[model samples]
Target: MLIVRIPAEGIEDFRAYEDAVLPLLPEFNGRLERRLRNPDGTIEMHIISFASDADFENYRNDPRRITQVRLLEKSSAKLELLSMANVP
Candidate 1:
């Protein structure tokens, strides 16, 4: 299992980023399984769950996603992408 945290700044910022990202979502071949917005306004985090390393890699390598991320980075005061292994 793969986990990633995307800091979106706030709910509005998350929504705006989601709106832009939605268009390119299909190209990922359904790799990005779930995306949840943190309920509290503290971190403004986006929790993403991916199936495997290959899937994660595919999404990361997509030029469209890369461009989208670059654009989002400029929009937010802080954007952090943290990769982790799922443990349970």
Candidate 2:
């Protein structure tokens, strides 16, 4: 599976980003696998798994996804896609 990792900075932006992106996952043939927040106020993480590599690519290239990335960058933060790796 392909994993998308978003590390959010602000709580408001984090929630807003989530709201904007969550619904589109299924459209891109992906699923929201998990969301984790650091109690120490470091980062809010989201893990999205896609059905296929092409689906992941579609999601990565989606205009809305680009917009969200820009939004995060504008907020002086960013997101990352943890390349395919073995997970237990």
Candidate 3:
């Protein structure tokens, strides 16, 4: 999962960044399983999954994704990454 913190002014830019990038997930055998946002819009959580760690890494390092880093930078967004497993 990704926990994101956004500044008020950065919200549009952040959403734009997400819109531009999230679609690339499937190329790496990944999916964005869910997205949740706080009522105040200060925080967002994205649940993502990939076939394997290597696929995730591949997605991260993909040139297309790298190019979109500017959109994320433009948004001045802050992010925290978490790895999760199901409770079974």
**TM-score, every prediction:** 0.50, 0.69, 0.93
In the range 1-88, model 1's lDDT, one tens digit per residue, is 2222444444455456657765564565443445544465434445565556676678778776666665455445355677766679
Instruction: Identify the candidate with maximal TM-score.
Output: 3
Model 2 global lDDT (CA atoms, 0 to 1) = 0.66
Q: Which ranges of candidate 2 are over 4 A from the true structure?
A: 1-9, 85-88
Candidate 3 local Cα displacement, residue 40, angstroms? 3.5
RMSD of each: 4.5, 3.6, 1.0
Off by over 4 Å in 1: 1-15, 22-42, 85-87
Candidate 3 weakest ten by summed lDDT: 68-77
lDDT of 1 at 4: 28
The models' CA-based lDDT, in order, is 0.55, 0.66, 0.91
Candidate 2, residues 20-47, lDDT tens digits: the string is 8778899988887777766753465666
Candidate 1 has a TM-score of 0.50
Q: Which residue pairs in candidate 1 collide?
A: none
Model 3 residue runs over 4 Å out of place are none
